[model samples]
Target: MIDNLIQGVFNGVSTGAVLLLAALGLAIVFGLMGVINMAHGELMMFGAYTTFVVQNIFKSLGEPWSDFYIFAALIAAFIFTAAIGFLLEKGVIRFLYGRPLETLLATWGVSLIMQQFVRSVNWVILAGLLVFSILYFGGVWALQRRPNWDAIKNWAIAVLLPLTLAIAGSMGVFMAQIYKIAVTKPWFGAQNVDVTAPKWLRGGLAIGTLQFPYVRLFIIVLTIACVIGIYLFLEKSPWGLRIRAVMQNRQMSACLGIPTKTVDALTFSIGSGLAGIAGCAVSFLGSVGPNTGQNYIVDTFMVVVVGGVGKLIGSIAAALAIGTTSYLVGSGTFTNIFAGIKPLVDFFTFFATTSMAKVLLFVLIVAFLQYKPAGMFPQKGRSVEL
Candidate 1:
């Protein structure tokens, strides 16, 4: 009985760790920018796929290099997703600032587009080229709009820039396709790839009668490291200071000459990059798939909401609570507690036969919100104002 209880707790903690990892990104992005990005899940998917790509690259080199691929992939996922996130913010999200409904719809569309692009290797290359083209054209337009450029120079810039962009974009796509045909086809064989845990992550650590999986332990450690890193970045770094300043008062921050738009773009990229890291972590536990990230998106939103938007401590506490509750309830430990009351036991047993645990969890969350609508740690600032 004690072992079961201990195991349950371990399971809950592991679940909470993942939730914290996934939710932290949303907390930062939504907390600072007030933009509910429905596409955050897709960014995570990109990270998982990035891991697969890196692993395959290393595999092609030789088995000797495979072990270290995950480390390289983690960095790759962050930078790749961050770059894409930066472009996403610059292209689409910037225009929808302060408009919640439009932002929601637009990001949802972006999510769909990203998912489709990730559905196949061919699509991924094509999407990259498309994005490159868009950014290229957008830059030209911005340069054209600049007041410094005279008419002839502007015309020359416009003509030369588009031609250069077209050639560059076409060359990039052609090279990507060639690599995909020559390398990826023989190596990966398919878009759906399996990412196995390293040998070191297998097996378990035994403490008396209870054993914990190393993969879960790695996840817990990674989450703690991320939490500490984010805390320091937010509290000690200059970028963090700007984010906080903007979060406190966007208008006031802008009045003081802080570039709010640039801040927004950076913040979004950081948040998206964090999600990418989480996705890379997830690949250690399971297969990377097109919809890999969608599985956790709802629970992530719940953690952010129940914890209170933008509150790091609140997110941590809420994730633990929810993760533990879900695990215990799913494990049927609560059945013993309800055994003393026959009617309640019977009722719960009836519901427990299916997904009643999740239903009960939702009811509790709804009740929690009813009592404290602002969440466990509500932000007090004009930035959160809609």
Candidate 2:
């Protein structure tokens, strides 16, 4: 019984780690920007797909390279999703700020488009587009410091136009050849793929009578690192201070010569990158699919809401509480405990199943919100207005 309880707690912590990873990015974006980015999950799917791509690339290299693919995949996932997030904010989200309903609807539409894009677009074309986009954006950024818009435009046309055409032509020819060779290949089809764990992570660690899987341990450690990194970045870094200031009072921050727009773009990018990392972590647990982001979106939002918007500590505490409780209740731990008591046993039995456990958990969260609508850690002082 004691061992079971210990194992349950461990499982709960592992679950919490996964939730925290997924929610961390949402918490940052939602809390700071007050934008309900419905497309956040799709960004996660992008990360998962990025990992899949990296894995395939490594597999083509050789056996030894495959073992190191996960590390490269993590980096690739973050950068790829971060770029997507940056574009998302600059293009769609930037125009719809301060209007929650419209922003939500717009992002929902974006999510649908992203989903369909993955399903319909060929893999090679998608990869070529990603590469082209990165180069195009990088060039634009390099030329952004020009003294005038005209100068920037001239440089872009003279330098970037030819580069774009060359890339497009090459990709077009390469894709045509590949298509001709393997017109019936499933790689060209939109389907789910698996990310196999490295040999080093396949085993479990034993502590006394309890056994812990390395994947779970890795996730927990990764979560801790991410939380710490974010904390340091937000609290100690100059850019983080700017973000906080803007979040607290956007008007005042702009008045102080801080570039609020830049802050928003960077913050949103970081948050989206974190979501990508979450996707990479999740891929270790299951198959990667175009719709993978849909699985964690609701639960992640719940964590952010329950924890308190823009409150890191609150998110951590909420994730742990929700994760542990959900696991315990769903696994019949409480039912087993109350087995000797007739009334309590009846109540526990009804709520012990996985689906019912979620229902009970939702009710509890709703009840908690009624008592504290601002969540576990409400913003204080000037941020209250925001």
Q: Model 2 residue 325 lDDT?
A: 88
Off by over 4 Å in 2: 123-190
Worst 10 residues of 2 by lDDT: 181-190
Q: TM-score of model 2 relative to the true fold?
A: 0.85
lDDT of 1: 0.82
Per-residue lDDT of model 2, residues 33-98, tens digit only: 889999999988998888888989999998899888989998999999999999999989999888
lDDT, candidate 1, 171-278, per-residue tens: 656666767655233233325668876667788999987889988898899899999999999999998999989988888899999999999999988888888988
Best by TM-score: 2
- TM-score of each candidate structure, all chains considered together: 0.84, 0.85
